[model samples]
Target: MDKDISEITDKWKNMNQTHIDTDEKIGPYLDKYFMKYKKTIYDSALSLFYALDTRNLRKSHKHEPISIQALKCFKDFVDRNQATIEEAFLEQKVILPACQFAIYRESETWISTICKYYHVESLPKADRIRLLQKTVNEKKFSSAAWFAIYAKVIREFNLQDIYVPLICQTRISVVEQLMKQDPAIAQDVVACMDKYIDNAGELASFARDIPGANFCLLNDKGIAKFAKRLAREYKVPIQICPRIDYNAKMNAIKFLFRRRYEQRKPMDKRTWETMIDSVFDLDSPASEDNNLVLELIYDLTNYQQYEEARRLAHLHRIPENKWPKLLLSNRSSPDRPLSRLGSGKIISDRNPKLVSVEPEKYSVDLPDDKIFYINSHEKFKEMNSYITKHPLLAIDTEWKPKLGLLNECNPKAALVQIACQDRIFVVDAVELCRDSEWATFVNAIINNPNLIKLGFSIHNDLRAISELIADMNIETKPESFIDYAQFHKSLVQAFKIPLPDYPASSGGLSKLAYTVLGKYLVKDDQYTNWAMRPLTTDKIIYAATDAYVLLEIHEKLESWCQERAINYEVLMKALLKKDSTKNKVNIK
Candidate 1:
């Protein structure tokens, strides 16, 4: 019997090698040769081999798609094991991925089998969307792989123009719970923002409704951005600004403007000057309240809404006895002082330094002792001790640009620059990726809520590399990542200033650095091949400047928050909650 089994196995091997073992051959081979020895180890081992081979087995005649071929193999495996399927999954486990792979290709058989498997009764519910929505049954709907797959189905199916409540509805129902455990999961959904635009409003609204920010991933800046975009799309002026600490040196006039902007009462912004003219007339209570009229002029002037300030001041007939000055002669800039009304208060005292510093003054000057470029595996091991002690870090990555047509593929990562205080560690990702402990090291800093990781448009830098994402297993885990780009938007929305230099929709790192730190980042090296050995001096500086400048930019923004009485750490820490009480209450 042993000799006979060896002979059958040899034929199986030969059949598999030549690609002659089609779905047709596998059945007979399993039935005729292996059927007689079902109880032996050969039956189990050989059965395992043949099941794997069957899954990949193609139909020789029809040239069916891989999805169909796998589905057929799965059906066969189930049919043959129907008697024992309820008791054991030894063979079922081998072919299950076939069903999963089938989700990619649209087929009747694929649809039918899923219905029977899940006991799904409705035909429409078992369709592509229902299955896409059914992914909520998994540990979480935010799986990066499923997010990609579902997005592909949505795009390929041309569901963009039509609003799909079911999509965001499914996500919204469970995200609070999912976020409680992993708030970073919101980052994944936000990462796929371009692919899921149809329901951006619903998603943003749902995010706002999540109540209490801890583990509420969707409520972050990305969704806030989408909310603002939707408002723009509908031709409405949105005031989706982050919470400002009113008690802490906040401008009362600015706060009132923000609150009123939320109501959108002055919908016709084109004619707002004509309308506000009447609201601040002498007969109106605004004129009687001296502080109200003066601050209104101050708020308008501060944001460079000078025409409105001029209109308000002259229209109200600023009496010399009232408080504050109105130097309307030179309302061209915030720097120009306002002349006094009756009460002797000057507007310049309340004016903050709201503009970027001179471009020439902005520089990233790191001493030789401060910069560490690690290119060797030995040097990579020493990285943790150097970086882990700091509670705040500014990180940026560099990679070889992809010259090929497949731009979707991630670039090969070369360097990961981490800046803290006076020290900057330019860790070579190529060498570190080879180390088994590399992912652990990365997660320690990025996922550590106690440690703040700053990046500009950060999700793209970390998520673009599939190889690194898999190595680090960070997709589902909550990343305590602070995307300054979104923060910049919050600042713009709150301040309502015309940022003429860059696109209003985005906060590019260079623009942020220039505006916040008065330093313009030289981005010529951005397109260069980063994987080259013997790193050039220009590459090192360019990389170091990107990471190092973030530290200063963050400090400037932090001061802005402090001046407004906003707690920067509290906002960041809110997103990093590892677990939430809400999860235990509603999660089933």
Candidate 2:
């Protein structure tokens, strides 16, 4: 029998060498040989050897997609031989050695098959003793080999009945050697055991026996669930220490686990308790553990379980001083002030360094019949003159709402409208430039210190204008203006005012107008050629209304602030600070 086995092994080895060296199709040859010696150890070993050879060769180019035909053939062979393989193990024939080689070669597939056939009753005590002895003798197998065998055993037999003792004994014998050679593999094995096993006492005994096994594999959700389970099982409180680095990943896993388990119906609670207790027994708390705590608090806050979050915070002894900053949630509003310091009353006593200025004055003299284009240099001059006359101008711009390309170049800036008391002048930049009388108006508005600019998101217009006229100086002062969108947002939050659903960052002038004024302004010519020589009446009206609405919105928001005694300087400062972060704009 030994001589015959040696001859078969040599033939198989030569065949493998030939397959490696030549490009001949080897699948048919393997199938023919495997079928010819169906029940023998020779057949089993040859089948496993061929399958592993094929798989390894393919794995060398692992990224390439696997051939479906080859996979199907391999899977079919495993399925057909599964019962025979298990029977061979039970009979302790020459097939046992072949089974060991099969496990090492196609570890994943063989383990999966074994797991499916695992039945304690089917395995007679004599066979079990023989298999155990084989496992002990082959204990020098690689970690990958052990992992494969362990996985199969766990899957095949009831873990409570068979796997626990076997794994414990295996670890006792090989853990020290495994740890010495590859500490990470040892740690991963311990973690896997901690996660799946259900006996805390057994796990603790194992860990105590194996020194430096300090890490637990429980994720955040696992930790929470495990902590709760331990409290119920042991009738004692278990403090869960957050391992922050791993918490997020663990939380994701726990969520998936809960979802899967719930779908599967009632699980064993005792099993769950054991698993949780075993995993968490390795935890130790640290000061940097606030992120996980914060995440938990945030989740609780989402569910409006504020009291529970607060209690957890207190019990954890988290610093109370940082609570306000950590716990506070920012709500979005359409016209919410972008500045953090740009809301509330101008307290003269507290913030004396902050400056307050009235809106710049400007006069409008364009005839109603004449049309003006927004981007015209001449129109800018006339508007500048009007602003100079009044020294306080309500500056605003008009552009296509959704057209990105048009807004990028020669953007129409119509209705350089000036408001003084009840009078509003729409200084048409295009029409005024045709007469060359707009330059003085433009100069006056540009040069005036007392002419404070007022608009919503005026920084954009300022930038646009700066690009249009190379030397134009728009007052970039943080306190020299009022951004109505930003002011309104702060007002909404501070006064608990109801706001529409929109991103906190989205506070376009048009949206603000629609929300605050209940009237929709037209922008028919917004996407029209702004640089076109002829301007339409509809376009002029659209441009004019853009600025006109700003003057109105500004007055209403200002009055609203005054009525509430809100400090405008503080609000502006907050907004200015926020804006500063955005563009690195110098506010001085």
Candidate 3:
């Protein structure tokens, strides 16, 4: 006990007085003292008691158990230093073991002493509920614990009117523990529990009435039935939720075909045959997926059955505009495995084999207007004047892809893409990078807080721009930027959407293009060297389309949120929360 006391005193002496106000140091000090002394064998007839106050201390050994004596000491200390104890509690200095002392002694006054420091209305919802849980479940002080929980419920109700569901749905053990000593509250508790469960089921049914609520996992059978009925009546496509069994997938497929056939829009024969074969082809040396829509289309194309493949597209109602990219491209490639070096980063020996593409056939739907090429100072100045007036612009940049993770080559900015409502300006960063007008134009868009700059995965783009600005010796600050990829993730987690997990760092631009525009964006030129001079017509269209489409996608997202009654400001707050340990942005 002397050594434990000395160690704790040393820890306190080592800590600066300023840091004593922080809760971080108190837990360790208490933990060491308790670990050493509480576990030591002591005389059964006498137990140690130590009391600490700002101005005095009391120490004794009595016939009572150590925990009981400790509780008495704590009460005396609290009586003398009520303000200090409350402040300590607010700092979280009073830990579970200390609470255990008061609970084991069954001292209502001590419990009240602790409760006065914590108020439900003063804390966040989660924190307040956690405090209540600790108080109730700390020990078998059933009467005092129940009173605290019941009071907390009333306080929470007064604050937000959100307490009924929480109190009613609290763990059954809590109710059982409270009711063992207080049978008078049993009837009221059980009624609240039943009401909470019934209300939950009704909420699930209401959610199912929304169009995209297929993303929600429905546990209630009646709600699932309601969703299925709505899907059938509205002729909506059946979306598969997670954990679906083989039989469930088969039934959904059958239901889809039956509805389509009744409407005289029966699926094509070849496509149906292909779908059946893929569903039951578990023995085949390929991936197991029930849909097989993409695999079947590719197989038909590989067999040179273009006529039948095109007919399948027609039957599926694939927009004539979207069919070519959906059915035309080859994506399967041998993975370019990476090798590691001394720096603990992955690097590849060689790049992946590039697939052949017809540059002449590459096209993107754009306005029937000429794209401005700002290679000279005068054109650069003119473009900047036109773009700075718009409150919103879709922005993007082009740079040569890094050869490897640890590739030592310093990347040079290739192009800067800025698109407004009617025009796109593709700046030649190689030529205009040193020009003052170009730097000024870039500064205006990035630094203006009121000007909304929209992009996909803007982190890398900002880094590249930073590098470019540094080389030009320009001081600029970027603000009011929106990365749609992060926005999509916020929406997904917030709405509990059942989309497949995408790579967390990527923009998922290809998926967004298909979802929002109802067409595919050609990505064959994605990783090509953008620094090459005399850019091909295909590359020019790809660059312009990449920037221009962000504006269109933003419009679609706004409408989607408005239709679903999602508050845009509230959704953005979720995306801005940073995980301190991982240094990653996360949905709060």
TM value for model 2: 0.30
Model 1, span 408-435: residue lDDT tens: 2356457888899888888777766666
Which parts of model 3 are misplaced by more than 4 Å? 1-365, 368-370, 405-407, 496-507, 567-588
lDDT of 2 by residue, 197-239 (tens): 2334545455444323432532333333433332232222112
Off by over 4 Å in 1: 1-358, 404-409, 464-466, 469-478, 494-507, 575-588
- The lDDT per prediction is 0.49, 0.42, 0.49
lDDT tens digits, residue span 329-410, model 3: 5333221211111223222221234213212222344564657777899999888888889988888889865421111234
Q: What's the residue-level lDDT of 133 in candidate 3?
A: 57
RMSD of each: 21.6, 25.6, 22.2
Candidate 1 whole-model C-alpha lDDT, 0 to 1:
0.49
Count backbone overlaps in model 3.
0
C-alpha lDDT (0 to 100) for residue 305 of candidate 2: 39
